[model samples]
Target: MQQQMIDLEGPYRLLYCSSKGDKDGVIQEIEKGVSPNLADYDKRTALHLASCEGCTEVVDLLLEQGADVNSIDRWGRTPLSDARIFGHEEICKILEGRGGTDPVGLDSQSPCYEIDHTEVEMDGATLIGEGAYGEVYLVKWRGTEVAAKTIRSSIASNFRVKATFMKELALWQRLRHPNIVQFLGVLKHSERLIFLTEYLRNGSLYDILKKKGRFDPPTTVAYALDIARGMNYLHEHKPHAIIHRDLTPRNVLQDEAGHLKVTDFGLSKIAQEKGAYGYKMTGGTGSFRYMAPEVYRREAYGKSVDVFSFALIVHEMFQGGPSNKAEPPEEVADRRAYEDSRPSLSSFIYPEDFKT
Candidate 1:
């Protein structure tokens, strides 16, 4: 029975070793008569894992052992597609040489060009916004204006950064909602990875709150409803719930039509259904001022974390901005989590219904 079990598990062992870049273990599995093309539950073959990981040696070994280079995973991604998405240039060259093709089709237009034949100067000139690992540029694509989100070239060569970008890109591409910012397509650049989206001229909710201080009750209600609808769509996603871990005004944008749309999903978490509280999540995610108490405490949390953040945003809508501006944002978050600190709702400022 033990021998039977080992034989049954040989394919998984091959996949594991391949993902870990364990060339020798892969060789052992092959010698034990396991096919190099053995796939996982996701239909991801050894070649697919090796390519995505940038494990060139393991990739080569698998190829030599007759692995199918064009094998498509459950997501319709081939080994070459994973390699390209992760910025593994050398591995990409090897895979392309082996006739590997991108089964997962991405928009092929280059959206980083400028009008009037002038070179795009990325030196803070065309820069519109900045994120933790990327910069957003206002660029021209086929005579239309779009926001190009680019990973900084300095770190674009790093595999981990590319992997994270790809993960976010994959998730964003599938989302369809009026309250969510539309993902236009991807642009392949030699220096960095670029993805495009519809550029919102009105800017973010943060900009609006900064300028107006606070909104009237009717306006606040409209804005809050927009955010709630978007959050509802995300949390109700099929297969898994997506928590916008960073649900703050800064990450929400206002469209030309004056409706709010959710953007910047960099810190979002796709919650896998487990128990009541959802999956174990990474702590310290998102801006401190809007972070949920459970997240600040690093405890297991669920979709309600976004609800907590939504409440803070609604508070800001009524109060003009984040409270306790005198102290650092981190201190404020710490107090909220540990001391149960909350912003005061003045009786004069809020309507009796709102106060209740």
Candidate 2:
């Protein structure tokens, strides 16, 4: 019986079975008292391989057998991060629902980009930006420069804050595009969680749009196309689609090369995962100014909502700062967005082809 091969062939069998998503092979191994978290040379567990290959059935089996969803491998990567980077949206939801830990690394198929916090030099660190959730700092790591997004030690202890941070980190790990910010890896500094990415010094599109006012049609279209391409990639991502519920100038970044890359997946969602069509999740997300009508109304929304928010962004690209200027005041913007009326551009000057 396969059960008799535990000592002689357990490691190879478990690794091979997990890699192949063979539920039966894994079950027999586990039934013979093999630990689900058993690792090979790299310390990668069965759950880790299942997560990376998006073996939903096998993942379910391993988890049912008490596999450690949050188990960290030798590289400090977790199964949750593995599911994320390969566009395994269903696996991501499963792992998240199972309370996966967030000690992260790049997907198994990609080159490991995780940086050791001990190797980082903090003397030259500079605070480049801040947000409600965390702050972005420029720091040196292993002789290379990187942007470290740090969560305060006090704030990191909050369960809600940690959940949100984990969600963003997971989603960000999956995205890889020239028009999307690249996620290097993550680090834990005592009580704080720090995620690192390639540092782009040009700042965000919000900064440039705020400074330069409205852009000409040609320039606006160029920026709009970059966002569109990135959004399209997310929308058509394999296994499931991703909706950037908050697609605005603020979430879009500009590199030193004058290229636009979409950032901020904190408010993003996975559409059509887990066998649910137009998957309905909690509502009332995204910025009121750029929010879709259905989203503002708390109605069941699909990926099209991103297009609605993207339209507002495209409008802002040509009309200057925000599309909400002509709407009701900030205090009543949500109500106005959902009730008073839909925002619109009275007129637009662009190429004839762009009208379509």
Candidate 3:
């Protein structure tokens, strides 16, 4: 296939190969004296295309072949900037390490720590959180505190669940954004998968809202912006966008700096044009009260569902209660959400133009 491409194209074989994610072909073409700095019609190099597609191997090959890492397309965006904006942290790291892009001012923080399981002190660990899939505990690792999620021992024998857990680990390991939880690492404790992460002493937004009532306008907007920015980064992510099919207040955690970082990827789906996964059960998935209509109806959904859920969250944040006065029956609730019914405004104090 690569040889066919190499023969089919004349001067721009390297760009074609990179665009096609043909790392070997790109290397061969470069070795054949094709300039690695060649650009396409829009002035985008193989590095730009590979970075946008999250073709890390191809990118590395290009850099090694003397490809200009700082090569910019018409938009003046660097490969490192594109990678960072699209949630490809490792790619950004590589670009930076190669002296292509400046990271001195960028918020690039990827933390990876290796510690023996025996070094983790679980004696003072306490139940911190829970979800349909697993349990979370606060434990001390290497004298620093962290949140540890334990894969249910009962499901240890479930092959599918185990596979999904490992998949989550793979995804989590690549994530490095200030608005997303930093995954420390994973450990095998008995029959459980213990996933460690940076612990936010400040609890979830759900806990704060329940205790303090409605948040002030500025505070609400601040938190909402943090979440929106995070979601935007995720949606524009390279290779595939991550749809947090479960974007509820409970999954949003606040840090000491008062910034919100999204947590949990169990129900996350890699957004694509088609073939997104969905369950066909009677009860809805991932907090129906905050679920998008498309998701509740078991229809094909993408990143927009998360935006819809965020709107619902903002509504609840203002209302200080559930979207529905009395949680409606499954059919009615589904119909209302699908029909674009807003929560009762008689009791909620919302800006008139909010729905607009």
Candidate 4:
């Protein structure tokens, strides 16, 4: 398949090979002295294709072959920019280590860029799980497992949403830690968003709790500690403090090693101050059951809101059911009153904490 692509016309072959994510073919073509910096009609080079495809091996090969990492397309986008905008953390790291280009800066010629990811072949890819957004399949890349999220066409729309999504992608690309789910890269097709990421085989904490009724104390404590550690990394990191407003069990995935990872930054925000947590009015978002009391009332809140949600998750882990189960009318009234009396940024203490 790669040879056929390489045998075709100039750089288009490289572009085609990169788009198809044929890493070996790309390396073969580059070794044959096909200019690693070759550009297509739009001035997008093979590096651009590899970066967009999250073909880290091909990208590394291209970089090693002296491909101009900073070469901007007609649209003024470099390989680094494309990798970051598509949430390809590994590719971004490679480009950053080699190119020294800024991923967050907007290209002058084109205010926006689009990724066209094809559906990777499903064979050999383990179907890990499915959700309202799409199906997540696990595949092996460079000897490591990666989660490939393929969203349907009906979910993606025009430039504005794409821009927002890319912004989030860039943010995730910059995140480097063990606890956060790593963004591998993106595969763009005419009508789909194929997001490749590090695969966590154990699935979500919610799944585990549901299937087992509840976790043993040690397991529950371990999960909570992992969650806290991840949240601390996000909230205390320099340059920008990320607030994961949605910290529900469903978003907390575990790996085979029993380590917890946080996923889905679609509702995350960057804090302006060291301890500040809330952002501008972006409307109510996140799962209702796990939402902070202040979030529901259109109030400004901060990192503590996540703490509150985390408290709720811990409560659920101990309760053996969903956190927002039916509450008596008096209890609901008391809860509402308590919420109204507290500051938006106040940390919520679980009732169980007092009982224990």
Candidate 5:
């Protein structure tokens, strides 16, 4: 009996080779009579995968071999759209030159508040804030000042981080409450991920506390109500509850009207279930200082974690600042967990109702 030949000719092999940036493999497949425009189940062609992965040579080869430049995928995305979304500038230019069009448009049926990147003027923009993941800049859009949050290139390079950023943007766009910061739009770019939001002139709650030590009882009560309303809105979100894993003062901004608005949904989680235990969530997701005991222990927690953090914020309002400021944040969290240490509330500083 003759040995049977192992069959390997299929769209999957071609797609895999294209996705892995295997130029020689792609050439071999094309030579073996595989259509250059052959698409996978999702209608994603070799050109689409190559463009997404920034495989410049493979993209050129596919185009030269007669790959369709304007093929649309299952999600109404073209090869050019993937290139633009993934920040493959060269691939985008190449596709555009080949008459590729993003006719479906990034704004069409997308979660983001989309705007042309060129519309936002960054000339003479001021650096307003920064965190581990990105920087915030004070920029102008359509003659109005706005806060532009840009993810650092180093961090944005991670595919998972980009996905999370998009997911958070989707959640952010759906939120429309006075006590919550307004999301303006996302600046479409070929190389950067930039989000635009309303620029608050009064800065954050942390800055206020640092400048004035603490608010009076009446003011604190008002601010607390504002925060509570915002958090309540988040928890009561339709379809799913959004838990703000990080609810520190720094993430709360004060408006020119003296009203407080909850901002920064970077670490928020959408609870898939609204049961007694809520959704099983990841621990250590937020700032250690405001981290709930359950979260610090890497246990499954729920929306109550936000409540715990809210209580701490209330405590900070009465106490002027975080307790045990000299101690490291992790140590403070440890003390709170093991020793049940809490910031002392001053009888003179807070009203009777507040104390309760």
Candidate 6:
């Protein structure tokens, strides 16, 4: 009876072997009467582990031995889900071709869960940037380069954070503009929420400006025009007007061809009423350096807020510093000042004025 129970442990051992990519160990374990359907602590079966590891051989062997492909883990994640989340294109294709089940439909429950860190594989991907809420990686998808934004599991669990993520996805799906970063798709895993979009190799305009001191006249004008065009499209072309509450150089990415793309819509809002730009009282929505005077004051404003930020960016492009430069006290005071009494757009004095 003890031997019988040991033989029954075949499936669990097979799962371990498959996860480790040890084909010989898997065969040996199976010969000892181990079941191939045994699950781990997370209820993930051997097939799930195999798919996640991108071990095509292990997956094929298990499938040939009559392993159920439709089985889901505790979180209702099938092997197909693992393949997609790990970006295992070939394995995913094979599973799909073999009539694998759709993991997305297993549970109508919110697709938020904890993932084992060891299972995630970041292949052909490079981490390029990070922020308070998440990190951004560059990946190649189907021969095209893309930017994959991943929010950590802990952050995704917060209601506000999750809402912000969903809202960004909604905005991206409906937005159609050349100057905006093209929305590719989203990947939800037990460990992270990943967003894939066009990858801009040149990084943000802020980095370039900070490194190079300032942009030339034509370059500055061109960048400004691209931002304006993207904002105009977002505010006017959508079913509901969209307002990009956070517009900063860091959110503006540049491609190899020098085309600018607006990105990071996490703080964006949809405008419902005519002439209403959907300004929120939330104080921490935007970056300090690029934030408009009205944004800091928590006053009701409209699309003009964006225009104000744009003007500041133009100043930064030419002045080699942020709008608040050379006036620390005034900058602090301006934060509490009313929106109507804030300094005019001319506050961004051009650098050429003192070039003599």
Question: What's the distance in Å from true for residue 118, model 1?
Answer: 13
TM-score: which is higher, 1 or 4?
A: 1
TM-score of each: 0.64, 0.63, 0.66, 0.58, 0.67, 0.58
What are the per-residue Cα lDDT tens digits for candidate 4 across 214-301?
Answer: 6555556667777886788788755677888888888898876667888887678788888774574333466656667666656788
Identify the runs in model 2 with alpha carbons over 4 angstroms from their true place: 1-114, 122-124, 152-155, 159-164, 274-284, 326-336, 348-356
- Against the correct fold, how does model 3 do in TM-score? 0.66
For residues 176-221, what per-residue lDDT tens digits would candidate 6 score against the true structure? 3447776655664534677677777788888888788876666676
Evaluated with TM-score, which candidate comes out highest? 5
Candidate 2, residue 51: how far the Cα is off, in Å: 19
What's the distance in Å from true for residue 177, model 2?
1.0
Ten-residue stretch with the least lDDT total in model 6: 106-115
**Which residue pairs collide in model 2, if any?**
none
lDDT of 2 by residue, 72-100 (tens): 75446788877876768899899999998
Model 1 regions lying over 4 Å from their true place: 1-125, 153-155, 274-283
Q: Which one wins by TM-score: 1 or 3?
A: 3
Whole-model lDDT, model 1: 0.76
* Candidate 3 per-residue lDDT over residues 1-356, each given as its tens digit: 23323343665767657756898898788878888888753366888767766789999998888888888654345778557645677888899899877332242222322345786766568998896568889998777788988777766678987777677666665564457776767774544667787788898989978888876555666677778867776776656677777888888888876678888877776755333444332235687777677667776566778888888777777777566557654654576557876566652466666656
Can you tell me which runs of candidate 6 are displaced by over 4 Å? 1-124, 159-164, 277-279, 325-356
In model 5, what lDDT does residue 144 have?
Answer: 73
